[model samples]
Target chain A: MSHHYIKTENLEYSYYGGAKAIDDISFLITHGEKVALVGANGAGKSTLLMLLNALKFAQKGTIDIGNTFVTEKTAKFIRQKVGFIFQNSDNQLFMPTVSDEIAFGPINMGLPKEEVERRTDMALQRVGCESLKNNITSHLSGGQKRSIAIASVLAMEPEILLMDEPSSNLDPFSRRLLINQIKSFTHTCVIATHDLEMVWELCPRSIAISNGKIVFDGLSKELFYNQELLNECHLEQPYLAKIEQMKEAEKIRSAN
Target chain B: MENLDRVISEIRGIETDAIDRGSRYRINPASRIIVCFLFLLSMLTFSVFNIIDTIPYAIIVILLTLLVNIPLSYIFRKTKYLLLFVFFIAAFNPLLDRRPAININGFIISYGWLSFFTIILRGYISVTAAMILILSSGFIPLCRGMEKLKIPKLLVTQLLFVYRYIIVLLEELAQIINSVKARGYGKNKFPVKLWSVFIAQLLIKTYSRAEMINYSMIARGYDGDIKTFSENKWQRSDTVFCIVSILIIGFLRFFRPFVFINNMF
Candidate 1:
């Protein structure tokens, strides 16, 4: 059996004026694998994430999401199978109430009313937001709003979860809570983030993106140790990684 | 504080009945439509014939208004907004007939002020009553009630569609204003020509958006039959609201003959 849940082969795409944004990027993630897409801004990290969810169709190559080939005809099916959490929590939390927002995708899928309610309850409880069932979207704090936003996609029970900058603009406590929530989920998740330290903590496998290309897809330990690679990507080694590097350099000095 | 407290203690619907939170009343939209039309007719009636006897009908109209859960304070406040228009109507009343101030006692009150007051008061009563019926019953239920009351399906459905579409249009309008604000138009009003041009642009966008929405609705299998799944079952509380409403309405309508002078009130 293949370990890959999402497999893309030479996925090429361009925007208006024939400007190539994402060019021939290929990646594979095993089932239940937590992957981090690390990149600076305009590096096509967001674009690739969108392609995986079929939000943006790849014209040149194939994006096989959960074993289904991505196409316009199969757009709805792909969308159902994959949940894409947008970078902006504002865009995701559109519905009036928390429960309704959570159940939006499922309802659009035309699930039975009872089934929708059951799924909503289950998903909300899973995210520890069952107490916020009746509250309106506008009244929620930024963290609570993000949690609810994630819960909305979770309610649909998507096999593959794509979250774009889940930790951005969040307080430390909220970020910790979010990390805890993500850790508990067994779903195959891909988080696009500028938080390199978070990537080190959460993702066992990291993909470094530079100029819309995957520069490195290696073990977490290797990604952390490679300072030159981080420099190339304009990413700094996190505090822990820096400390470890300092200790290693000292060890080399003592040995020499 | 004292006057407001007095007003609070004497709210029209405070003693009526508890509101049915589950919302299960057959609010006949057509009934409200018909009643509002009648209320409008009464405005014409008082204007055409300037008799103080018309005051009774106006008083009855106000009493009917009190039947709904509309607070008396709310009514007083809303009517105050109409006072500017009321001034124009009052101006016309005095000119029609300069009837001399007639009184048995030494109190000489002009018939013009009296007639104008009666006309305006009656107009207020009618308008307020009509508003209560419209607001309390709710636009949706009233439409449904009309449907249940054997209004033609086409008309009922058309009314519902228009009502539902209005929300979308209003949101679109708000969004356009917001975009305009984002581009530095929010803090200040525009020139007349510029405002008109913006409005025209908005109207075009709104029309196209509505058309797109209609297409989306059709794609989503909206075949025009809006089957409501909400449970609007009539309960004991609904019956109580109806009963108390009728009693209060009856009391106010017939209170003229009894003339019970309040001791404390």
Candidate 2:
């Protein structure tokens, strides 16, 4: 009955013209786990993330979130439990103002006005964007818009979070703030990103996909150390991992 | 490209002014909408060549713009482009009707010219009033007011979505035009022959983007209805504002104040 895990079985999805976006992919992420989904462009990373919350349903497989299955009838319930932050902040934020954007999900879920207000305030505080509550959504800077988009999803209080390129187009300071915010979350998170450095610093596990298939899934260190696999998946070792390797070599050379 | 940027910035400015808390004329959006409706009705009641009667409505718009602290220059600038279209529509009037309608001293004025000016005046006044409504009450609040006033929810929702996405569409267009300009293809004029292709590409891009946006909305629990967070209550002041505005609009429509002034002259 726990609603904190996601399990997919042999999922497949193809666009109308018959190009497969996700081809026979499967993975399991348990409660409170932070898994980084890393892949090159067109590697189906976004498609898989959408599949997790029924934003894009699989044509030939099943996805189970905790004990509940993701189906047409259950998408509404699944969406409540799984919050999605789209790669483009503009697309995710449709409301006019920041407060309205944050309150949208909760309001749709039929929460009381007071509870919605509390959640809105809490989410804004969580993202450190309380000052932008009344600002127009279209007028926000890229970093502020990303933060508000995250806050909007966080207001729903979902048990699982699926973020697609959350740090994309953000400045260094904004990305660091986002990293800290993600690090503070206790919910199970599946982040599809190209920022391997973020993967090293935050997620303990990494899943690398290539050409609609998951090529590697294991500990973050293991993935970073496998240069062959990284190259095959169009990925590079995390900067932190490279630094650690260089430091170890330096220590050995000095000892010799 | 510069024009697009100005438009985008102008929209942002209007949004800011719409939500400004210090404006003295911030009434409930529903009341403001009703007043705007009545104002438009009164202005449209003037027959062709009855340009003098529109003066009172024009004064009301100017006074409201001043009361709301929106500069006259801003309103004028926003309505100028729209007035060009009005000019286009009214341009043929003089050509079609050459019969003289008035003689001021030695100069003769045709009915067509009078009608032309009257049409331009009416267009300017209507566009300015609408701009005032949006400036005084933000677009979202206006839609909510429409909903409260028994406008169909579907139409209101469509209006809200169109308003929200028009910015995105414009941004996309700017990007496309910028890229085209970078390639040195759109210097003097965007090649007329390529317009069809350009429009098709833009449509495709927007359609896909719209699909992605729809998916995001669905993921956030968007059902058929778009629920809002802020609900403005209809205060006693709103009722008073509505009553007084309707009364004034009624007087302007019925009394013919300009004719009395002319008689005195």
lDDT by candidate, in order shown: 0.69, 0.88
User: How high is each candidate's TM-score?
Assistant: 0.63, 0.92
Tens-place lDDT per residue, model 2, B1-265, is 8999988777666656677732455577888888888889878877888888888888888887887787889888877888999999999999998899999998999999999998988898899889878887888888888998999999999998888677767777888888778886556576677878778878888878888899989998999788886757799999999898888888788878887677789
Q: Fraction of reference contacts reproduced per prediction?
A: 0.00, 0.88
lDDT of 1 at B230: 31
* DockQ, structure candidate 1: 0.06
Number of the top-ranking candidate, with lDDT as the measure:
2
Each candidate's DockQ: 0.06, 0.77
What value does the TM-score of chain B take for model 2?
Answer: 0.85
True contacts kept of 2: 0.88
Q: Which parts of model 2 have CA positions greater than 4 angstroms off?
A: A246-256, B21-23, B88-113, B185-195, B259-265
Error of 2 at B230 (Å): 1.8
- Give the alpha carbon lDDT tens digit for every residue of B31-76 in model 1: 4455455545544554433444455566566665565545667777
Quality of candidate 1's docking, in CAPRI categories? incorrect
Clashing pairs in 2: none
| C-alpha lDDT of residue B181 in model 2 | 82
